[model samples]
Target: MTGQGSHPRHGLVDVIHAPVRLSIVAALAGLEKAEFRFLRDTIEVSDSLLSKHLTTLEAAGYVQIVKAGTGRRPRTWVSLTPAGRTAFDAYTESLKKIIDAGN
Candidate 1:
């Protein structure tokens, strides 16, 4: 058994565990990609807030961010990396384990 207070095997992933980041990952998990504005609105966060978390996720190699211009203005899109998808899957499985233990 692990020492007291030590993380369980397959414990929650720290980087993607944050509420906002979790929501972001969950949202992207089902899609090929999502527009920045769509995520901002769906997650109900400010532009800067979403941008900030996205940057963190990007740095962790969990997500990719792309900026492009269609016409007059630039657009940003976000998607999960393979690593992110794997981590998210693990996270959900860990969550299920925890919930089961509590039952």
Candidate 2:
């Protein structure tokens, strides 16, 4: 019998557990950086919703948000941090373990 009592899913990072946040992380994982509007469109969330989730991910050190451009047009960019990538890798491994457990 296993000594550990907790499920592998318990190892999931709470910050990235939410659907929207998870989507954000997953999307960022494949790209060096993406514009905020592109992410919002890809994730199918409103600007405010994306901003809210980005704030949470930023607070958790899982994402970096940058604002650029000048004049009438400014752009926001988002990317996963090194720490975020590490955490996401671990989270996916935990999910794999969970799937294996069910098999």
Candidate 3:
């Protein structure tokens, strides 16, 4: 695992180390909060994949899931915690720096 300080040019390399997880985080970063289905559709991933990524993020304490009963169906909503937002912002900044360095 890469430490945040190891890659001065990419502080978020650790957070987005997995491509799928990276995409998941990126997608979540764009929304204030989103439904599970919405995230799955936006990311174009299967239920298993989305669930796996969400589990990972949840375990990392980067995301929060809210379960609510909506009539006959149950709705699951996901949102980034403050820690997640900070991590995502740092990751984006690192990516920008890397791109700038390459240019």
Candidate-wise lDDT, in order = 0.91, 0.95, 0.83
Model 3 pairs whose backbones collide: none
Model 3 TM-score on a 0 to 1 scale: 0.86
Task: For model 3, give the 10-residue run with minimal summed lDDT.
Answer: 1-10
lDDT of 3 by residue, 3-56 (tens): 435454647557556888788888888889999999889889998998988898
Off by over 4 Å in 2: 1-4
Model 3: residue 13 alpha-carbon error in angstroms: 3.6
Task: List the candidates ranked by TM-score, beginning with the highest.
Answer: 2, 1, 3
lDDT of 2 by residue, 1-103 (tens): 2755578987799999999999999999999999998999999999999999999999999999999997789999999999999999999999999999999
Decoy 2 TM-score against native? 0.92
Q: Candidate 1: minimum summed lDDT over ten consecutive residues — where? A: 1-10
Give each model a TM-score. Answer: 0.90, 0.92, 0.86
What lDDT does model 3 reach? Answer: 0.83
Clashes of each: 0, 0, 0
